[model samples]
Target: MRELFGEVIHTYTRAQALADGSLIDVTETAAEAGFRLPVAVTRTVWLRYCEWPEELGTGQSTEGRLWDVLWLAVWAARTAAEPSARITYTLGVVPVDDPEGDPVDVRLWAAITGEGAGGAPVVTIGAPEDW
Candidate 1:
């Protein structure tokens, strides 16, 4: 298991950040180096990380999905970007300990600075327990 921190904001939020002048993208960058986690699995892990809003509903509910929450978080970051904004995200990958089975990567991320009243950020991405 290893912990990694990224100084860069999410590419999903790049356009808004550039428009706000909070961040400037000199060039396009490749996606983060890691397995591309699925949205359904990411949703499950994120739900485990924090409480779900009544409106957003739960994992079993048919309301807000992981993609929805992710968009919400990105928008929050873009909207909230300011001279003092220090919001950040950290990713932790825990590899499967099995010796015979192929190693599986379980990834999770948290918003470090700008999360508000609720312990959860406006949005978060994570890996499911099974995936």
Candidate 2:
């Protein structure tokens, strides 16, 4: 493919994204939620769902929110009929600024990469549009 496409001009890798803050590594938290593979979340999802700023004065913790996301992903993956490259799931999240408000349903996607490419599979979770 590279030969047909000629010399590569540029490439942006997942590692670069992680280092640059475009992708937040949540592998540790994901593992605790029963995931064995590496996991990450796009910055948008991080800010929208996982992040719980102190100024919000809410009881919600970032770790708890992140766990909810990953735990739901794990459950979805396990229940899927067949293993695929992408898995979509939805979860309810109470807004940080409005903790008393009804939970909003957010659809998220988890994509698996590096399968037959010889590297271990990694999971990236993001908003539906992020895919």
Candidate 3:
């Protein structure tokens, strides 16, 4: 798991925090960004993911979680033909200096995608067992 996500975690710690992620009407720009985002996003959802160290002496799983949302001007436009179309974003995470003056360790991410087959968006994450 670290082999797949190690670089992402490493770069996240150095990423700039506090970004503006307002919605953008991207019908005219999806193809340009190499983004096949949908023309119209039916809804947007907010999610928070947390991870706690399980070692014997680790503490504050609830309080130690540190994270930052990226500056994402993300928007989904129509598929140019299909109305049931959709979009997705790999919303990146960033570490911020917490009240303890420590750099946050990101164990998960905030993901984005069109509503699932269940008619609602999916949210939250759990660490991989192998990590």
Best-performing candidate as measured by TM-score: 2
Instruction: Encode model 1's per-residue lDDT on 19-88: one tens digit a residue.
Output: 5643322111101212122111232444442223445322322123333334433444455656322233
CA lDDT, every prediction? Answer: 0.33, 0.87, 0.28
What TM-score does model 1 achieve against the real structure? 0.23
| Residues 1-131, model 2: lDDT tens digits | 97799888997788888989999999888988998888999998998899988777557888889989999999999999999889999989987668678789989999989731257688899998775
- Which predicted model would earn the best lDDT? 2
lDDT of residue 50 for candidate 1: 26
Model 3 residue 51 CA deviation in Å: 3.4
Worst 10 residues of 1 by lDDT: 26-35
Best-to-worst ranking by TM-score:
2, 1, 3
Clashing pairs in 2: none
> What is the per-residue lDDT of model 3 for residues 31-85, given as tens digits with 9 covering 90 to 100?
3434343221111212232223344233434223322111122232223233322
Write down the TM-score of every candidate. Answer: 0.23, 0.88, 0.21
Model 2 has how many clashing residue pairs? 0
Off by over 4 Å in 3: 1-49, 56-58, 62-101, 105-111, 124-131
